[model samples]
Target: MTTTSYRTAEQIGHTEQGPRPLPALGVQTAASQPSLVDTVLPNGLRVIAVRKESVPMVELRLRIPFAGMDRLHAARAEVLANVLLTGTERRDRAQFDTDLAAVGGDLSSVVDPERLSIGGSALASGMDVLLDVLADALTGAVYRDEEVARESERLVERITMARSQPSVIAREALQKHRYGDHPFTKEMPEAAEIGEVTPEQVRALHKAAVLPRGALLVLVGDIDPDGAVAAVGGALAGWQSDASAVSLPKLPDLTPGDVRLVHRAGAVQSQIRLSAQALPRTDPGYAALQVANLVFGGYFSSRLVENIREDKGYTYGAHSYFEFTKDNATVLVEADTASGVTPAAFWETRYELGRLVLSPPSESEVDNARQYAIGSLLTSTSSQAGLCATLVALGAVGLSYEWLRDQPMRIADVTAEQVAEAAEKHFAPSRFTGIVVGDADVLAPQFRAIGGVVLP
Candidate 1:
């Protein structure tokens, strides 16, 4: 064999003096707008269709507000989502799969405290079949006893396993600490609740909660926009109802206080979760706040990551991100570290939060973060699936494609002074409250000495 020569990674990366500087970002070109139709059908469903033409497949997303206040509502909703695609009036379970497989189509259903969402894709030529099946399920799904029982058994097992995970335990503690007794905190039903869910309860919930009114359906693919909307209107004509789907109750504003320590016995690792209320996407200052969040811990190059992961060896990963709910929003910071180093990690996290406000991000730091925010937005929506999902989220909050197309400009306009202002107004260590979950025996003494932490 002939020998081949290659430069080593270190040789390519370094010169006599140092590593090479990265190339500057090129000017961003605006994407051409697609043909679109946004209309409310006679049956009250909002259908948004766009001609992306990037691939020969179509992506679908449907969102229905499905919140409730009853104690067993979560159990019923879980069982309902799991068994939604099992069968309909016209097709049995096998027949449903056969029809979908013939068109290279598949669908999945998932529910949270806010909404019941269904997402799927199919070959462009099979869009009609896909819509027909979806409409059939929405209008006439029969939650047969046997199918409900089987799915409930499987869900019980999954929920049981999930509740045992340290992440899940920490999340439950954080939710309770942040928003106690709110229906929004009922994200996962207890395993025993699943056993009590009956076929009749699932059927009743579908009848009362899965209405067409106030629901949104988004379709994007290689098809005519107007034609797709017309097709959707025709397929879903029979799914009419007078009552609107229920939206989740508004969340209470978070109260900042001492961090609570939750005891997880025998756990070798610990989770640190913190939260603070922030502006919604609709707020004028949201762009500046977004940049500030990026500089703090939103990305790998953030100060929190550099200080804790790169310097202190505290954790393998850390991140900060916005969690949006309807018109409300909050910024959350999360890091997972070893039990032995948990207190140090907590101290560093608060120190960085205060530092972001006191010594605001520099001009270079703001520029890098602004560029990342704009670049990530464009990259995420370049694909048809991503576009469909993004539209669904925007649509849920009374927005549309215009807001998406205009976001890059919004981010580009944010100045360093604006970022500083946002950081000062939002990132104060006193404006946050959360939970530190680990073995109390291991974490108590160190956290007590560190202060501002409530013991078990």
Candidate 2:
């Protein structure tokens, strides 16, 4: 028997090692794309529809822009979003759940800092019924006091559980540090705050903030474009639009400073978050920055993951990304490592930051990131739910559908230099705010040696 070891091509009798060919570049030209259709109903409601007949199900997303800094109305929006799903005028909670289960459908509502979204999925055969239920819940919810109380208790439980989780605590602290004094940074309402909410307040907020003018209806599935539009338009025709305009508040300035850390005793691992203010979706730099972010830490093969996880084994995983919004944007780097290795992980993170700033990405690196982003977009848009969600989000921020469709091309065209420039501009080490949630006593001296460490 002969024993043989695997060897490189050069050692295996090849004359020489050859460079591989680069991936196919510039496949997507600017001209070949479909545009988004926009229509307005007689009742001042805006409807944006994208017709993709590949799926048997339809996804509908309705968003009403009523988010605010007012503690009272903000709490009301949250309570209303939950209670509306609990029961409606025609069905009790149990009956509602049964009906949805019978049809293999799901309904969800969420209140974020910018808007309240009510969305659901149902088969084409059940579209009319689902639409009717959604309209009834949005336009005629009872907001019963008992339901509110029950949901408030549930929320309190959720908040309590979230506080005990290191990841959640780190995220909340990062948001506070990023948006100090802004509504986005407002502390989570306590149990007492939840108890103070009244049914009347919820009703008032629904009437004022959930109007048709600020609302957008997005439907994607196996349905007729004209008929679906008319159906949704007629259902919401009676709701009044707010004639008085609402504008999003300007983003607060980010004061650049040293690393900030939050200490948590008894935590076996440290959760680190570093972030800086970023550009909104409308910025031309948005596409380039996204490409840069991927190279830095946006994916498994990113620099952060390669250096911090693969090379050094400092943490389980490391990643970074940019969150785009109408009023503000943020870029974040996150990781979790054993308390003993927290300092080493932080130093490696800093090194990656410095290295990316010092040298821009190579053309091949930029192309790979661009291809990944574009491929992701193409794959996600193939789903009815994904397409509908994208349409709704774009409309909510006053962006056209054409813009969404053209995103892949724009991403493909981003140059390597642009990505590097974006990195240098958006990620300045001196401006980063870091939050560490772990055993402070064990990790403090190491953390302080790296830079600034802020205890909770």
Candidate 3:
């Protein structure tokens, strides 16, 4: 209904329209890459500063490889991240918040089995204060009893809620099935065990996991690169420790095998999680593999989404992508469906997987995916926040902003034949393994008929 308007249709300029076609090729890339200042502090902290000069803000990212010493380390690190910024010897929780607010900044910390990462931003002029506050937290976090108690309880509550989620359940099952006793399996810790962590253990964990030797700090903003790097050296010069920074060893290659059934009795939906070994970003043909994934299922326009969602209505969405760890990479394919249609979705996913190798993508498919991959990379790094985060990953692999800026041209150079080869090598259905989470009585018999299940 129009509400006292001349006419809604007229205002909106209504007209019949048809879908538009994608544009032809263009030499689109980042206009120019940011100039960079890279250096290492005496304390063994690698600082990478990029001169973005777009806005008066600086984004900071610190990556400390927080690999757990053992299974219990994962639980302790969880609690540590939650309470890390809660208080420090120089300031209580409230004071800490006030100081950061003064600098137009906020900081947060999180830890996985691979790394303990701290990220935040501040006004460019207030960069010194930001660094000071970060240094304070690193050097003198108190982990007071009351704050630890409160944050631990909150962590438990959050984890409890997360565990109840079907997606989380599926992921947990997949990790357990894939890596029975691997430290990587500790990515998601048990909530009950996490809640039992004490303040002293958190202190010990901070000491062990947060060493600066070989750690990386990435800063991007409107600033002079040389001065910025030198400033960082002065500010964090004291963040030294005799202990080496934590790092994970290489991940074992994935071997395709039978699907493990994780029966969720009486569930209304099932989540299919499939993964296979993949190439790291540094590997040759990785750019082609990246494009190949996009053509298969990495984007909404890909074959998997076209078949499973738009054409057949098996699920609301389906996607596949690569996950890079510190040591290795894995491709993940996921889709959620009603319990009754679970088998159909599974069949189509496997069929798509097999077809990728048997038939391969067309020239059009390869080009479209390449364009998207390039456009996304350029756009994502176009801002300070984006570039700051990008630098950390790049830094981890001993790459730089120059490499990222050149990636679009590198991607455009990838040919359809290369993508096809990557598909044949990596996308073969026989090269995948996974688990299905649903009602056993309903799904068990169906899965068994398809093969790859042990009879009870």
Candidate 4:
């Protein structure tokens, strides 16, 4: 047997299909350019406006950093987000929808884990009217008790449906197992908790989470930045609240050698997820780890896909990622395979991980992976909506366009040594936490042969 060293980089050269040409970093393509102007309001609402002359329509996204509702005030934030569109003081539900439809405009809202977003699109000519209506709905929503009860029932039904799905069950189980007692484990409230949500609770939550200080407004398409700010500011001027600062609990330390399995009967395919604690977005290693994950399992031609899908044909697809965030982060590998082939798939995943840890990727592999990452970044910025969304997400993460403008160089600068070092640090097999959802009798023996198994 040939002794393979994991420390040395492999000698694989560029494939028959050579590297794709990198788009010139300073290429003046119309599609790659963004016309965004940033400003701040007196009350501290940050506005990002992008001018798109081709489209006659406009899209506006309002992001309120009231994610606190899900943790400290769960029911209240949820109900307020839902009730905002139900009706407002100036317009009832019917009139609201009618006015929007008359101008071919539509409004929608969602309360995410970290923010409440209200978004809509309309003809550029009707932007002022659309902004007014959206403003009224957000700042003057009437959370009537009857509406709250009705919405609560709807939420309960939705939660019940989510529980019925096996994939969701496995995902939720993984979150609970990984996070343990952390608030991230608590998704939707229990039915009893939903039943106890009162109108007063919704009001208080609205007061705390919907304040202007913790909000971001992104507008795209034909619109004047100054005019748009004035309109939005005028609408939200009356919205006042003594909302407190958002404080997040320290993330829990993830223990290695923790394995969790959830068995679901009558399942045709097994959902396997293995993860490890990882670095946050602020880490200097983020860019390098991104390249490592790409070569590992993030792309179609990645190592995981090449090993599990192309070489072995055990699963449809397998991939891994690092969820880079400010307070918490995790690296995960997920895939679904046939019940009979689950064991083989799991071991193959482990084997590939071990290979990456032992042997660094070849120079050509590193170049290809870097090129793919940079290409994707350019593609994402090609669309107006995608561009605006990227800006909004960067802002949320405390980054700016200047940072994004420098990403191409950063990705290109990543070397084979850096990718190898990142793999060794983040993808160590000994630190892995595996979660498999399948028939235990068939899977347990194989898992036990590989690593210890914890069943639930």
Task: Pick the TM-score winner.
Answer: 1
- Residues 220-263 of candidate 3 have per-residue lDDT tens digits of 99888888888888788778887788787667888789888788
TM-score computed on alpha carbons, candidate 3: 0.94
Q: Model 4, 37-72: lDDT tens per residue?
A: 787777777887777765787787887775452444
Instruction: TM-score each candidate.
Output: 0.96, 0.89, 0.94, 0.86
Kindly indicate the candidate among 1 and 4 with the higher TM-score: 1
Q: Please provide, for model 2 over 248-304, each residue's C-alpha lDDT reduced to its tens digit, 9 standing for 90 to 100.
A: 466675666666667687888989888878777788999999998898899876889
Which lDDT value does model 4 have at 218? Answer: 81
Please give the clash total of every predicted structure, in order.
Answer: 0, 1, 0, 2
Per-residue lDDT, model 1, residue 64, is 97
The lDDT leader among the candidates is 1
Give the alpha-carbon lDDT of every model.
Answer: 0.93, 0.76, 0.86, 0.75
Residue 88 in candidate 1, Cα distance off native in Å? 1.2
Worst 10 residues of 1 by lDDT: 19-28
| Model 2 clashing residue pairs (backbone) | 261-454
Sort the candidates on TM-score, descending order.
1, 3, 2, 4
Model 2 regions more than 4 Å off: 1-26, 30-36, 98-103, 243-248, 454-456
Worst 10 residues of 2 by lDDT: 13-22
Residues 114-226, candidate 1: write the lDDT tens digits: 99999999999999999999988999899999999999999999999999999899999999999999998889999999988889889999999999999999999998999
